[model samples]
Target: DAGVTQSPTHLIKTRGQQVTLRCSPKSGHDTVSWYQQALGQGPQFIFQYYEEEERQRGNFPDRFSGHQFPNYSSELNVNALLLGDSALYLCASSLANPIYGYTFGSGTRLTVV
Candidate 1:
């Protein structure tokens, strides 16, 4: 089965502009988790969606939000973005029961000017 995949391997935006990144989860998976991995740092959990509802969240502002589609894919949206928001946005997928670990996509590198 195809693992998770993200679009626009890289992105560039201004400090106050917004951006939207997309993701497709692996087969047989219904949960999608978004993560932010800054340079030289571990991926930080942004939020997770299961059954189209947010099941978990991390320490991030409202500027960071997401949505899960019925097809089990997802999108992360950042509003009023700041320079600090620039980072590698990753999407990970796992089983609902989560007996196994998550599978991550290569990620979309975002740079803010």
Candidate 2:
């Protein structure tokens, strides 16, 4: 009965370092998607995964990647991070054919210094 969950609620990294953020989807959910929210801006879609395969991707660069496990959990990885990459990383989960809307996690706040 749990909702989406993200690990390392907050992280601090330096330029050029890599970071991996994790997320556990809600029960009975099979799709996982990632988003990035910069300060005042709304969440921007990064990518989506279903059935362990990436289904759709946004305008993000190749540095942004994700993986969906068989259990429906997921991970978002950012390589060679830049200060501009700092943002609130959000994870959303829902059924493949969503009835309502996706359940989002509290989000991982990444600070690049």
Candidate 2 stretches greater than 4 Å from native: none
TM-score, prediction 2: 0.98
TM-score against native, each model: 0.97, 0.98
**Candidate 1: segments with Cα more than 4 A from true spot:** none
Best by TM-score: 2
Best-fitting candidate, scored by lDDT: 2
**lDDT per residue as tens, model 2, 45-96:** 9999999999999999999988988889999999999999999999999999
Clashes of each: 0, 0
Residue 57, model 2: Cα distance from true site in angstroms: 0.2
> All models: lDDT?
0.94, 0.96
- Model 1, 1-113: lDDT tens digits are 79999987999999889999999999998999999999999999999999999998999999999999999999999998898998999999999888889999999999998
For model 1, which pairs clash? none
What would you estimate as the lDDT of candidate 2? 0.96
Model 2: residue 20 alpha-carbon error in angstroms: 0.2
